[model samples]
Target chain A: MSTSQGLRAWLLTEEPTSRRQARMAAWYKGWLTLRSNTLAMLGLMVLVVLLLAAIFAPLLATHDPFAQDLGQRLLAPGEGGHLLGTDSLGRDIYSRLLYGARISIYIVALVVMVAPVVGLIVGTVAGYAGGWIDVLLMRMTDIFLAFPRLILALAFVAALGAGIENAVLAISLTAWPPYARIARAETLTIRNSDYIHAIRLQGAGPLRIVTQHIWPLCISSLVIRVTLDMAGIILTAAGLGFLGLGAQPPSPEWGAMISEGRKYILDSWWVATIPGIAIFSISLAFNLLGDGLRDVLDPKEGQS
Target chain B: MSAIDIRNLTVWFGHGADRADAVRDVSFEVADGESFGLVGESGSGKSTILRAIAGLVPTWSGQMTVAGETLGPKRSKSFYRKVQMVFQDPYASLHPRHTVDRVLSEAMQLHGVRDIDTRIGRLLDDVGLGPGFRFRYPHQLSGGQRQRVAIARALACDPAIVLLDEPTSALDVSVQAEILNLLTDLRQEHKLTYVMVSHDLGVVGHLCERIGVMQEGRFVEVLSVEAMRRQQAEAPYTRHLLESSINSIR
Candidate 1:
């Protein structure tokens, strides 16, 4: 290489020593923690596979999930060109299971992303401001928390009419209260700290303090809660889909597939059983990931 | 013009019956480039006076000003740009998560001050820290180092007056001397005014030209450091406190 080219390459590769050190430390810590947690690794592996399968369902699926095959209805498992058998409607059970993962991803993403952002903003404002704002916001969160999750979701879906969007909305509405409570508690502790007082004295406004200091501290706990909530969110989505409150027929949803197969659960078995296992495994993986994250993020929280 | 002027400053907490005065009917003035200290024991309202000036103590009835401008109920950014405070506990005053760079940069950023890199480097150098310490987190710093960072942050806004609330009480005697010396040098170098609140006669003695001895939310005596050092306090309480403080050092 020319000297000028070599100099350019060297400049491009160079990083500040502190930044490089911090990144390496983080990367090594993550590697060490992941190596230690066998169950989490397995769970992560399962999630990766499910994610890829969902993404590549069009390519991975042996047959179309929606195509009716009445001529070959009730094909048993291990039958020629049919794997995990065909359903009562002669839809490919394996293909539906693969496609069902897409629905689960949507619900999980909404619950984990939307709920925390809204909750963090609301709770931090209430906690930092305190007094009447605290009372008003906390009371609203408490009222939402008083009802059981599924019942509130059911009420919301009932009121809004059935659809994937409405079910997500219902879940998101109910899910935020727990996060609000968590973020509020975290913000209260942070608001009273001496540094916060110092910054207030220096004329740092409420907006800067909340977004920079309060939000970052509260996020670790919020993330842990979100990870743990994923299982419930998936189940809630599945329940909504089963009750015809989420993605309706012609779309391959795990819960809807299970609901449709319930009549022939004993006759064909693969129809409902495969989708049931899919739900169970994904829920189990999310729980594992949540547990692992808590330990990795804060050792004390993990211990408690 | 006076750097800080407070007349009939009174502060209270809670409603009737539960209501208690923290600082009662206090008045003082520290002139431009002058260092005035309020010395008192715990619960003597000196800290409250300082907090009130910083706008931290919300319930107050007072007329206060900085650099000849009367302070309004709502403190403006312009007002903040004229006054800043250095807190007591260095460890707690510097944010645990923020780096020294962030801590100093924020003060400048708030006032829409540009040339952040040059300013940060200058402030760090003023605090006796080099450029390498900028990105290091507060946890990575020593107690004295953290206080220097806090001092740098306070100075970043180019405030005319600094309120020091027992700035050295949280440090060791040896480290305290270093911080005091740094404060003295910085005050001279920048021509900054100060209103420091402390219980230690020796501490305030190092910085103040005039020291107010306070007790139970009232000023027992407002005398020069030279008078305090010369055992010339007219009030019996001031004499007793000074005598005891002098005896303790031996």
Candidate 2:
């Protein structure tokens, strides 16, 4: 308790002794704002629980996720040793759900990593290096924006063949255009700012200006945007999985499990209903977190 | 030798259909250690000339020689090393995210200044700020404090010429006098040359030895502060400007 109190006092100090303290103070201030928001805190807690479930899936599962028994097919919830009952193939529903969390987290991780970086580079370059470069990159982004996200992803997945990696790749391609647009808009404004001109007068080159100066300003808004878009990315991944273009059969992916349970949906609702609830909760959690993050991270929303 | 020499400098904006010359065929020179001021009304292109000299505005045709080196389509790294600029708005000049130390250190490091930790402390002290101000972000500082940090950043490279674009215009009037006095002391201590652009003749008169009165993209006359004070100006526009400045002060 004393250590935490000391840390809080340090973070709230008006005079920081080092750069690290200042950075931590800023982050702590943001955390404080986020904590004040009850709904956002709830969403954060849900995501934390999801993450823990994904990490400890092996220890938490009652049975092997893939092990099958035709005799015990379609058991209801709280029956026998199974916690959430069994799926169509008698694979434990509770265990499959736990394993499925890992795949969902992996997809989110990959898409988050791949999409935003590609968008940031392309957007900052296009925005900072204007004229023909701007025209060229923006037109490319326009073309990407022209296509419906799912249809485009479907095309990429169909051509690349069905797999989780291909689904992530396809989603990343579709996801980047909006980030590029946001970054470009941000860059256009930031490039003309007095701070930028001040840096340029310091003998800093265009490369330095775009990478060091402009990117830092652009990243906060981009981060807010990325969080807001997380729901869509997850939904797109699930859509691909539902169509059998993601995390092939026997992988226990939530969407693919739902696809398998579609036949049993009329009688045994738990087979499909449970996984659908999982997807809904996760997506809703991201959306709530994104909204809260915008309140904290968006400079426009900040006090002058 | 002149610290800055400009020959037939013409700066414009937009393409053929919408071509508007912001500064046309303007020329001037400031000798070493001289403080020159440009004063005019809004949209009179006083700041445009300074932007052109700094190579911030690329759409200009001129011969700008700074610190004995001729400026071309691009300003060399040494040009930046020799010349630095303090912008008009302190609120907009410093990066919102960067701390005062980061702002000062980045400037010195860009020019390869060694022993940055000590230099930053000294720079802050030189600008009348304590070492405690080092780790605070721009938002944490007041307008006067931010302007002081901006001044410190400009002095980081020890440039021979410092361009002031209405440096204290955005500041409170009380803070303005403190900053102007600070600039005066910094100039004398460093033996620096200044090319300042401002609409407030009182400010220009306070810090500058010679004031150039401009009108509609043209220099009406370049008169010394003595000539301006004595009301012995050359152009009718100068007399009019002088009358207005005195009127505003009254």
Candidate 3:
């Protein structure tokens, strides 16, 4: 009884100074909570470094990413003016690393941005509507999942032909199924929740229940999934580039640089090594960041 | 006139091999400004009756009319506007991600309410939550506070009939009393009609003017609090329930 009185007193206490003050408090709390995760902070630092490198590639690189000097071809690190040596086409490995960051960063940003919106819409509709709609939509998602991811992406790229746009499309198509599956599961869990039922009872429509109530609650998991998928997307783009299906020759994509320099592995190890390291570092960073985010955003973990 | 009227309602779930009827041959009426209680154990279709009325459980065939309009295959906005529901778990009934403001505002927005902020403010105040709580998320509030917010959200559209499915069952005993008091106060203040489904006869006795005892998807007896206290149960099933509860408590 005393506990209940104390709770009531707390609830009825004087209001916050203002809405802005309340918002600032919430923001500060979130930031403080997020900052506690060391691994997430490290991942964030790596992401920032990659993003900075991608944004200022022109300023950071002395030699042009695309320019080739045939005489300098197959040069090892510390040879002539090439810092990280030269690819098979004689493009500077340092400059290509900088430029390749642009492709990786762009693909990650675009895929994460596009896939979630589509998946959230489709999954929310299917899960919230239930019955025949749910059955039809889930079956469609299953069909997309039936094919192995890389093969399906390869098939899509094959159909759309090679280019950045086709690559983005392939990744987008392959990526949304996971989001759809996750969002569907989330919606299924939340749809039966009391708040959702309460919202429905208030005469709020199906769309409102999904967009306002369901989506916001599920967004944290969706965000973590998107971040994890970033690593896979970068890897897939590189794989395609290796197969000569992404970023045509001399374009200086990381995988293309590796493919072009693979023959010189014994002598000019730096040619493929630098770009390979960049890919590994960036993908690893995103995975770690995603894991950290999952820990932080989870309510059970957040409270502790 | 009846605020909510239902006749011969039946609800079924699953299909073919898994199919089974969950609610069968149920009928009741709640008069305007009256509180009617439906008491039943788990799986007795009490909650399903509420869901059927709310249009969440659409697999049911029933004659359900709220505010004199006949309910149909698709739920109309008007039907929702008049009849709303408060669910079992306060913890789950309010979306954890939404602020109390957004939770209330979204409902008003869907109903195309004008002057949303004022309406929301008034609702928050009506539910006894201070203005500060309006901006706080569900996690920030206590269970009772959250339930209050849930009640406020329900009252946003000035719904005439509110279907309450075990609203206080999730709270502590003392907290349950407080919520029950709040609910009773709100019902009286709004002149609202209530169709509360609960297993607690004491709660029903405290709040409801009429009580219906359900078993196996059917009402075994519908009686007033006076009838219940007098131990004047008409049906064998209601007598068994009353006897069992009495025996357990003793």
lDDT of 3 by residue, A1-304 (tens): 9998874444433444345555555555665666888888888899999899989999999798888788888788768888888877777888888888898877777887788888888888998889899999989888876767668667877787887777777778777878898999888988887777677666666776788778876788899888887888888888888888877777778888788778878887887788889889888888889988887666434331
Clashing pairs in 3: A194-B93, A195-B92, A195-B93
- Give a tens-digit lDDT track for model 1, residues B51-156: 8877787888979877777876677778778888899998778766566777777878887789998998898899898877877667567789889998998899
Candidate 3 chain B has its poorest 10 consecutive residues by lDDT at B92-101
lDDT of 3 by residue, B29-74 (tens): 8888999999989999899998888888879886988888898977
Full-model lDDT, candidate 1? 0.83
Provide the TM-score for each candidate, comma-separated.
0.88, 0.98, 0.90
> Which ten residues in a row are the worst by lDDT in model 2 chain A?
A295-304
Best by lDDT: 2
Q: What is the lDDT of residue A210 in candidate 2?
A: 89
List model 2 lDDT by residue over B97-201, tens digit each. 888988889999999999999999999999999999999999889999999999999999999999999999999999999999999999999999999999998
Poorly placed runs, candidate 3 (over 4 Å): A1-28, A79-81, A147-161, A299-304, B15-19, B244-250
- Which 10 consecutive positions of candidate 1 chain B have the poorest summed lDDT? B94-103
lDDT by residue for model 2 (A73-153), tens: 999998878889898889999999999999999999999999999899999999999999999999999998788877877
lDDT of 3 at A153: 62
Model 2 pairs whose backbones collide:
none
- List DockQ, one per candidate, in order: 0.32, 0.75, 0.53
Candidate 3 at residue A203, lDDT? 66
What DockQ would you assign to candidate 2?
0.75
